[model samples]
Target: MISFHFEPSSLSSTEKRDRLLKLSVVSSPILGAYFFSTGDLSSPFACPLREFTGIPCPGCGLTRSLMAIAQGHLSQSLSYHILGVFLFLFLVLALLYFSAELITGHPLKISLSGPLQRHKRLLFPLLGLFLLSYHLARLALLWQSDQLLPAILNSPLGQYF
Candidate 1:
């Protein structure tokens, strides 16, 4: 069996948290650019799971969705992939939180940790179901819409997709 394990470092909690927060801030712009870049949008990168087994991956339209959101088309972005919208919002919030922590030397603390940890058994399956359903709906919408193809193709990033 192959297994992975993570051992907490000896670094002070504050130091570790600060380092993580700083990393998040530094990577935000790069992530945003990658999300919005036209160059990567047109790449012919095939989904590994899809290629190996001829099944569409759950993340197929994510890139297009990100591109659409980056271009300021919220409705079209959601139609492309709901995950993209969620990701965009999450990233934005995370960036803001990290920035605030960095500037103020205080971290945002979530109060639901105890309940969340206790409910992991249920939460994991629910998360999986949500993701699967969301992706399938996105794929269906993509198939039904012809407008999305040309719109994506016409964009500067379309050439790279």
Candidate 2:
């Protein structure tokens, strides 16, 4: 089974520092989103998949969702992305856990990966199917609103379609 046990005395100084560094790298974006205002932000680029095919990828609107979350607008965030709240909570929890470990000089000892390995076969396909269906539903809504054709036509690669 894979599990984390915190024990300050279980890790060397180098191990603690290395773990903290990795956690810091992963948590940087969460900090940025919390401190920055989305109103002041503008995108210089579009999603490559969307720019080319005019269909949003699975992660589309995630930035906006994070921004909304940062602004304390949970409903707005949900409107931007259905999965945003879960992602936000996961990041915040991970950041807090790692920060606590760093401050207390504790390291998580993750032992054996059998449990996760056993679940992957069932988990991956379910996740993929959910995403595919969600994307199809989004496309149907856009089509119903008469926005689908325009989106395709305005895309850089749409002329070939």
Candidate 3:
């Protein structure tokens, strides 16, 4: 059996890569659940933020998109969430890359923190701006179309609002 526990500081670059890959795999079931299920779990799985505030967060449709992608419905995934395809592909690639490193015993860890640290100021703000813009646009469109609030209000948790 492959041991999933490893001390990070004691890990070789290859081991660390393997650890990262395993961590990604751990989330696969959840992503699969989202991909396979039609989200009838809303009663139990609803986002508390959305349930109470009637606001859709940036990650709202992520799982459903993954489900669509799992079924080979790329366009539908994108329709559910614009960046879902990218996120899903990224997770899959990361898992595959790390798993390969673990099996090959190669230290192919890509050190990105250095450059990201160097450009933190610019990158952080840009990321924030992009997220804020996307969220606002999503909210604006939903709000203007008079859909978000009503839908939230009609859900089982509507009494809370």
**lDDT-best of 1 and 3:** 3
Q: Which stretches of candidate 2 lie over 4 Å from their true place?
A: 1-4, 38-45, 109-121
lDDT of each residue in 32-63, candidate 1, tens digit only? 64655655454235566544443357886666
TM-score of each model, in listed order: 0.57, 0.76, 0.67
Cα displacement (Å) at residue 51, model 1:
3.2
Residue-level lDDT of model 2, residues 59-102, one tens digit each, is: 77776777778888899888877777878887887777777677
Residue 73 lDDT, candidate 3, scale 0-100: 77
Better of 1 and 2 by TM-score: 2
Worst lDDT window (10 residues) for model 2? Answer: 36-45
lDDT comparing candidate 1 with the true structure: 0.62
Give the better candidate number (2 or 3) by lDDT.
2
Evaluated at residue 142, the lDDT of candidate 2 is 86
CA deviation > 4 Å runs, candidate 3: 1-21, 24-44, 111-124, 151-161
Query: Sort by TM-score, best first: what order?
Result: 2, 3, 1
